[model samples]
Target: MEKYSTNAINADAPVMLATERLLLRQWQRRDLGPFADMNADPEVMRHFPAPLDTQQSNDLAARLCQLIARDGWGFWAVETRSHAEFIGFVGLRETKPDMPFGSCIEIGWRLAQAHWGKGYATEAARRALSFGFEVLALEEIVSFTALPNLRSQAVMQKLGMHRAPDDFDHPAVPQGHALRRHCLYRLARGAWQEQQP
Candidate 1:
């Protein structure tokens, strides 16, 4: 998936964005431990195929940096501002053409098991969406999850995205697999701006 050049405003001084409880920022070398710990959780990987090891986590960090440099958008290392501890990641990615949709960018999040249900995903996602449209001037942003992933779907809804029923099976996942089938939800730039409080 090739991400388009973004006009998203650079975070002044790279200062982190603070939600009610979370902080979104660039990944740090120290983030590897917590990131690996989160990826090693089986329940967290349940929605996907498998948990990643340390080497995978390290590689992912490097890869994410490249993506951020190239597209000005990538998964942000998320933590708690109060505690200043690493929790997980939340941000955006280019929607693969293989994915079931038109040209799109996807908003996504993943938190450690301990951080689940803390509203971190929704809060951080709201900030990312703001950066995308209000700053990047994106035409649209979308999100998707497996048919069984009601939790993620709820988060998308909370961010004001509406379900787009014309979905297709994810080619990345094997056919007949539980996670292959997905549902897409989208929010246009105008619609998202109007929903701003």
Candidate 2:
């Protein structure tokens, strides 16, 4: 049976997930500059709507922190355990403003160009799935990205998320926007556990 329970959910949850080469933790004030730089890079933001400015990056981080403060799990700042360099973030987020699943969460990730092809996103995303299914006991977790963002779609496939037929224009984005046409993928708790190595 799918293990979907909200009983373990709580705000004020601790952050800090460490892998062999990476550390996923809460966003720090000092990390904002580099984070902003990443978000502002056209190459990095190519799949996004547009490059974000410093204030926008700060606001986004603040909002993510607040979400974690309220819901117990949110995007995590990803860094190298060896050098402690902030490369990107990965975690779970609620689908907002005309969400497909209605009161459901999704797993997502973003990485700097310098960190691309390094498998950091896939590695961190795997851990995030562990937290969602094994720890949080979430029933299902979904991920969505622009139809053209095949890199992200590849990562989702690597993490074992199956594509859904329904394509929705993201309400938060303007209609006819390139980023608005999104393809969704989903993985149920039982399927996730079954696919584990």
TM-score between model 2 and native: 0.92
Candidate 1 stretches with Cα past 4 Å from truth are 1-16
Cα lDDT for residue 167, model 1?
67
lDDT of 1 by residue, 81-101 (tens): 899999888998777666656
lDDT of each: 0.81, 0.85
Tell how far residue 47 is off in model 1, in angstroms.
0.7
lDDT per residue (tens digit) for residues 64-96 in model 2 = 877777766789888999898999889987677
Candidate 2 local accuracy as lDDT? 0.85
Clash totals for all models, in order? Answer: 0, 0
Cα error, residue 8 of model 1, in Å, equals 5.3
Q: Which 10 consecutive positions of candidate 1 have the poorest summed lDDT?
A: 6-15
Could you tell me every candidate's TM-score relative to the true structure? 0.89, 0.92
- Candidate 2 stretches with Cα past 4 Å from truth are 1-10
